[model samples]
Target: MDALPIAPYIPQHVKELLNVSIKLIRFQYIDYSGILRCRVLTASFCLEQDQNVKFVGTGPAALYASYVEGTDTTPVAAACRLVPDWSSFRVCTYAARHASVMCRIYETLNSFGFRRCPRTCLYKVLEIAEKELRCTFLGGYEIEVVFMDVTKSPPTPFKNVVEWSLMEGLRGRPIEILEQIAESLEAANISVQQLHTEGSQGLFEITTGPLRLMEATDALVYTHETIKTICDKHGLVATCFPKPSAAKGLVGQHLHLSISSLENDPIEARTVDAYIAGILSHLRAICAFTLPSHDSYTRVQDRRGTNGTWVTWGTEFRDVPLRKIESTHWEIRCMDGTANVYLAVAALIAAGIDGIRSGRKLSWGDSQKSPSLMTDSAREELGIKTRLPLSLKEALGAIKTDLTLSSTMSQSLVEKYIKIKTEEAESLEKMSPEERTELGIKYF
Candidate 1:
């Protein structure tokens, strides 16, 4: 109906280049499982007056249920249109002739629109944050991915280098690919705060600075695509799968978040407290969207050292699911690459908005010790009674019963998401641990 919001501010040079030199446009969106999907068009076709919105078959909406196995489901069995948000356009650093922009799905080229779209869902949550709380959500991600040499029968780690954050860990093609990924990200106007090796073999992390909610999610998708594309060009596979192998440690999509008033001032303490409280209250339910796969639970469970099993928060504590950072932001460590970035972020913000609106008290105290280590009596004393869902099915069950979260995110979308994930979780349950891990690597 209304014009899309103006693109976040970009450098004048980039703006000039995009207006004059961009030749092709890619309309990109992520399915429920965070897989990147795209449709390409010539710059001329995109600029035509009649081509403002492009048609995309509705099959992608059921991507979570049918993408891995070509089965059509009800929620996405029809056709939809992709309406590109010109404001979100960015030059494709990996492809010199192409540029990309994010899109929202619509039921028709001219209509009220499809409300169940993942991007639309996120935008709705952001609007609630802005209108009700008078605060804008800001976020960034620490994305971890593992590189593998797929030439082998079973993809092997790209290299044996396992030194954490060490330059020596990236020696041959890995270093070159990382450098290119960094360069490509910057070229797309996505700031790279840091890029370093992780503790696992062939694993690395890229940290980006915060942007407004939608922009941050867009950047994250592009970041994943850039890394994967570059690795492919180098004849290696880059997977953000939560746990490609038990022996190589876990991969996480750690989210850092903050809030600011409409006037751009930092939010007050009460607001921050309420927001964090909301997240804690709905943490278990929200995991259905954040950690959407059976393998995701395996990576987050106790003994993974990822701070996933407990529902606790603390300042600078790595063993807590929600860690307060720099006294200004919070990091959610339960998520992984399997999550649809849009859905994950939307559910999180929606839950936080509920907290702010309800003025819910922040109950959980700072826990220096891991929940796994705390005695049952000690945990009871601290009021840390809740545990995160240990399986995809359990997480979906929690979501189905969570009134605040389910109501905030529309019941229709939540129900569809649960159905799809339930099927996936049940299917995975029939397999052995090794089989499950292999399937995770293959699909995620």
Candidate 2:
């Protein structure tokens, strides 16, 4: 029962996790202020849920257990179930508990009458997508986040950031952080395709192997927790916000996705193109969730695509809503680390599936490098309309227009998220940027 403070878990389940791994307590969610965050689990974090459970987030319903004896004081990391050839996972979690329990929960749920997709927004999005396209959708996702040397003895507003240097950005000893991240990701079965430094200061990315809907969601949460811990140990802060800092805060999580059929064939050309169209059509609305923060709009642009401009395909057009990485796959650029990963990715999946089902027109354009690379007149003429919402409230209103999308985004969750965000925006409005700056992660 969800009682005051979630009570202590049933002794049996706690014992089971402890027996398997006792060196650690369960995974708890804490925000930048070191407050225990909430974990919203649709079901229990029972070990048996391995086959039945789908994914977990910071609501506090589930956590990993490890038996390393005296490792209580040690820092822990998160690992995903990535396949091989991506990153080595063992050294990755020198401090992490075994993820076997997580898989067990998933496997057990499947054995029972549970759907591979859980009863959550991400699942609903996947479900709607499959139903619409009348086909299966495989998910291949990757995101980027930035880290800084912010101390936590007592947190402070993040005013300092390392400007990304193409020459020395990740070229120095700092690159070791990327190596550790890759190893930890691999340990959890998550694979890393590559790691890179971004154009912004201290911005970095860790690409992961492809996974289905639920599993992909799990990986995203785990990645954040893992990296955050590591960053903390280094006396730094890892921020996934659309833009954590205004001086040079263009932080975003670019999602690279690939969809396939029940059969092995991929959604190429026509369907894929149409899928892009559907995504673009629904993009402004989707940003209501992706750019969920009041400051989220500040991080978007078409020039570099930070302004959340057009939904056009271009060559590394960071500002474009959707940039074609190749003929088979493309990455959406507007999403930020601050947006709920599950909500944003699920919106994309649903919107694209809608595109496929609607048999909409597929629109493609020159993949420019950044917003500056493309002229406004040319972008408009190409039918690549600009629809990035400037504020969180504006984006939420845009998302509200799509009744069908509301189906994908649970009204309950949206209500809570929007209510909190609206207050935040108003609060930020009351304070000068400097005042808001002193309080770290006000939106997050």
Candidate 3:
């Protein structure tokens, strides 16, 4: 078994944590399937005097656990260690006497981070952006979830449906649940920019204020966990599945991102241009991570506010996937809650850095109108030369062919990821839309 030392990972404020009556410590990590997995230890166990007593063991396959029912997707027979990043520690507001800390996966006690660890991939890319490119990123997610009363036969919406942003959506029990969620997040120091009803039955959207890349992802995970925990406590289910119902229209976890110089100076115009260009250039391949699930592709239809199929960008345009808000800020409309956010964000930054390094230019013109509304010649004149991969299989294929993007994320990890996802796509392809939707609601 791999051993993770407790001393180095423990925070200086251990006494403060104990004073809060925190009894259980959860070492959490996001698996390849975007599911949050954890191992719990009693707070007393962490105070052991014997050095040999301070370790937690995990199987390597935990990183490759399938979305179907948490089964191992790979046959790797080895132990893995969970090294807690003490910085991510926060009191579990939803669970009394509990705390959570994000972890980094290691193959052995002495080894560096595991190659296939999604968190590790994100850290490496972030470091490259800061140290090499002299840039740092800030981002936040617009989370959309559909609440259901699972106790009902076939399940039904937990609240009476209302129009988008209507105050009635937050009335009664719904408001109570959201208030508790907001309070929990605030206790953890995660800012809530806004919370409102979405344009779908039983769907609600929570937008968080921007933070540094890693912090933003961790907050998103925590926020998701908080929402589910609160809903479960009230006998409801919250599913982040995009296109949860084929007829209910699409809902996604859209990511808004911005970049600034590492020293906090104004970002260079060329750097911004190349970064956006880089993302647009590699948009097709990046979809493998952003719009990951089989159901995710169903949300990519044209003229449905799902972000159009075209590989381009426009200023505040909902039809295009990449919507530029300013020279430094852009909103990526393709991502969903099914994505492993760390890996998704890493892929985006890496691709953008690749463009910055290569000094690529943003050649595509700003699409003022949806391409679907434009004539063929009109789109051609605007340089909308490519389209997003239309299916999970096609997206996987795109990632495989984009050697630069794959190599940057580590070729071995990419191959393993592709293998796991290829299996998922094949398995999902055999099922009907209803079955797929049911499976999605069950897990995601």
Candidate 4:
């Protein structure tokens, strides 16, 4: 028998969703504060060919809502639009009758992306890297989360302690929860590289396979949502907060990145060297994006198994903030779950591209040991002259002072981000330690 043909006029993405029996399409975007927001539409409404059907109006303040209280800081008069990037459509296997598509914010329905939109900013930065530097990047992230049973008085974690990456850590219900999360993500077309327990109490890490920069970030956001949703079903709260448990351990969102020459050509030795050098040079400033919250600084001082405190790079060294995995591949350990993934990636890539343009030299020697362990003279010999910012305030100062880094992004965007984060840090500083942790748990 002959096969029936697909509809020629139907949008491919819509058709794919309809094929999977999706009844609702959710237009989603991550804001500057790293919170995911969405608007929903019936699949039939989205299937319309009209361009107006693809755009959803939102308030300008939606882009800068404060992290804690959800306060809107922007003027109320201006409005924005969410235009779905159909290419990023993915079925939400955990949510029946629903699908999700990442959206780009625009000033008007007919306009290009809004300058303040983190995702749009990232797209522009990636375009620069591909067009000007003749390079592209593949990136992956390690999502570390702690699950707490909110039913308890103090919200206790799983009573059992799970050793890092050990088989014995796989237990009954907790393991089942993790298994379901992995399977659901895989069903959503996100590649799950590995799932294992971390040393922290009730903490688990999911390693996702790398994709091109944009897709990888999209996957990271979706992964966070999936983890939260599946855990809620099991009567647990999953938080990616950097310091969810102050006494137990910290959580991180370690990033792995690799660079490639355009068209699969061999990347030059100098290009690779400069890229790493660029990142190191701007490490402190980049922290403003990668580690944005006051809680994030808690991880910096605890060097036992946390991100190293000093600014340096080393080969195959977990203690260093930056680890050179190979010539073109590297691991950044300082990043945490508090960051907007889009802005973080954009800053990192822009720094690397800046390094290439300036022909920045790799002046620092590879450290055989953590900078803290080495003698001052030994560190000086290796040109390890700087420390990662010690606090959220200091990190914001670093961003403010680094004109070279700020020049890469839109001036208004940088100012607004800095203002928002600065206010958040100030507000967080007023709360008691317990209050801060509780708020982190509630919203993260």
Candidate No. with top lDDT = 3
In model 2, the runs with Cα more than 4 Å from the true position are 1-18, 23-119, 131-134, 138-142, 151-167, 171-173, 305-308, 363-377, 411-416, 438-444
Write down the lDDT of every candidate, Cα atoms only: 0.77, 0.55, 0.83, 0.82
Clashing pairs in 4: none
By TM-score rank, best first, the candidates go 3, 4, 1, 2
Q: Give the residue spans of candidate 4 off by over 4 A.
A: 1-10, 48-54, 69-75, 108-113
Off by over 4 Å in 1: 1-20, 49-65, 70-77, 108-112, 263-266, 432-439
Worst 10 residues of 1 by lDDT: 1-10
lDDT of 3: 0.83
Please provide, for model 1 over 30-117, each residue's C-alpha lDDT reduced to its tens digit, 9 standing for 90 to 100.
7666677787866666555223333434444533444444333545335566766656778889988788888776653433355567
Candidate 4 lDDT over 1-444, as tens digits, reads 011112224466577767568989788988877788888878777776233334567876667777665344545556787766666878898899898889877664322246777887788778888999999999988899889888876776665556888777767777799899999999988889888888877888999988998999999988999999999998899999887765466888999999999966799989988988999999999999999988898788635667788888888877778888899889989899989889998889889989999999998899767789888999999989999998989999998988877778666678879988888888888888888888888878
Q: Which candidate gets the maximum TM-score versus the true structure?
A: 3
Which residue pairs of candidate 1 clash?
A: none
Evaluation by TM-score, superior candidate among 2 and 4: 4
TM-score of each: 0.90, 0.71, 0.94, 0.93
- The digit string of per-residue lDDT tens for model 2 on 420-439 reads 45555565566665454444
Q: In candidate 3, which residue pairs get closer than 3 Å at backbone N, Cα or C atoms, i.e. clash?
A: none
Please give the clash total of every predicted structure, in order: 0, 62, 0, 0
